[model samples]
Target chain A: MAGRKFFGHAEPREIVAFLTGGIFGSGLLVSGMIDTKKVQGWLDFFGAWDPTLAFVLGGAVLPMLFVWRIAEKRKVSVLGTPIPPRPAPKMDPALIAGSLMFGAGWGLAGLCPGPALASFAIGGWGGALFFLSMVSGMIVAPTVAGWLSSRTTS
Target chain B: MIPQDWIWGALGGLMIGGAAAIYLLVNGRIMGASGILGGLVDGTGRDSMVERLAFLFGTLAVPPLLVPLYHSVDTHITTNPGIIIAAGLLVGVGTRLANGCTSGHGVCGISRLAPRGLGSTALYLLGGAVTVFVFRHVLGVI
Candidate 1:
């Protein structure tokens, strides 16, 4: 039942998602596109800017489109299991609230989850701090949000 | 070893990707960095504590070992540690509120063509655009 709901009860959706993310991350690296400096510089458009980042994203995406097409045509689960695509979200308050918070954080830190994790390799106090706080945030926010949701629902 | 500049970005992405793959293959998990780190601190997932800690440390440490191979990147960041921490906290909040981060939703979820990921990634992009505008333009951080 659960399988059918999310991925057609055939293939393990988690495996598919994991491989998808792995390939995507690999794509980021191959393109030299995961660099926060590159990402930040791209964000710094109009001043000291390098717009090559868009090309990187495009390059990564174009290949992904082909992969998706092949996967769809085969209709065989990525892991030989039936999988249904997960549901998309509606434009609601959660998106609004989340987007605002994410934007504020990313704009300031210039370190989203991907680049922040990547930062750890550089042996900087900055990466350590970012990871620590990000971990903390991960632990704390969910519990607090869950509590808040319970209260609201109740 | 490797060249400078690309060390952190390349090594980090590979390690993270490798970990994600292992988790999926072994535990049937997606290996979202945020989710793993969160599970580590809060014990949200069913994995044993030792495994979780190992996973967390592996995620955090492997990349640093490769530092000798890469050069430093010149990105603009405030020297203020306080601001960086605060920003991380806010991102954490945002991830929880959104139910996933870029890896979880943007890469993993979107790759699966999940609808939630599509909506979430769109918002994430928009939010990123708006924040950059505010910081670099309105606030003139640059």
Candidate 2:
């Protein structure tokens, strides 16, 4: 309230967010990022690697770069919401370790969170299992961190 | 004729970026899927429940709708329950620990030229590439 401005009711903003998410989901579906074979293939650089994932990354990044540039000049969003804070640039252990673990998991399964969710429509029970397990992991992470910190302190 | 997958992949990427841009411009939020989900589950995002849920609802609902229109939403996920569970848990814990994932660090973070995003992206890619090499070439499990 003090630092940021809340425009109108959150309903409109929620609707907009939903619409944006729909587009994002559709894009992931269409781009083949949601497909495990394609994702695996892209990661298979030494084997029969497919370069499509790189293209998807490039394609997605190009436009957002412009948006970020515009964001730099503005204080509030187009809807008058306060601009979110930029994450600090520090490369702490958590960043590196978490990313490494995520990458290994991604390579092992050929599915990240986005594609994992998208796969729900088609991946059947396997998808459900992955989603459930991933959620469990997320729920447990903080506790794990706390435990680790306690162990280190003791 | 253009390769259908390439064309569609690029088109989809543009749409994803556009969606991210819209979320940023209109809602004043970063469209990181893991962050959104992680926060909601972890209780850190209580203040913005409506916003997060709305965005998630869109993401979850739209894909199923498109399944009828396009038969290309198929996924070739591994059938091994062990691998699937392991991967899921890793993604869950790893993303929360790292604070981002492909969408947050790979796409949105890189676009903003943030160091953490760049570093996370590079490390994950490296990690993925290495894992692939070991699994496919050495162990031949996948």
Top of the candidates by lDDT: 2
- Docking band of candidate 2: medium
- Per-residue CA lDDT of candidate 1, range A21-135, in tens? 4443443444444455566565665556655545543333333344444545654443453323435446545555665676567767777775565445552677678767877
lDDT per residue as tens, model 2, A1-154: 4112223445788779879889988888989998878888998889998989887998899999999888867968988988777877898777888899899989988889887765576788988999999999999989866765675556
Candidate 2 residue pairs in clash (backbone atoms < 3 Å) = none
What does candidate 2's lDDT look like per residue over B4-110, in tens digits? 88988899999888999999888888889999989999999988877887778788888788887874556888899999899899999999988889999999999
Q: Write the per-residue lDDT of candidate 1 for residues B1-142, one digit (tens) a residue.
A: 5444345444444444444444444444454656655665666654433444444444444444444654643324556798779878878878767767766666556555667777777777677666677777787762
Evaluated at residue A4, the lDDT of candidate 2 is: 28
Instruction: Indicate the DockQ of the complex predicted as candidate 1.
Output: 0.26
Error of 1 at B99 (Å): 2.0
Candidate 1 error regions (>4 Å): A1-35, A44-49, A52-92, A121-123, A143-154, B1-27, B48-55, B71-76
Cα deviation of B64, candidate 1, in Å: 3.3
Model 1 lDDT, full chain set: 0.57
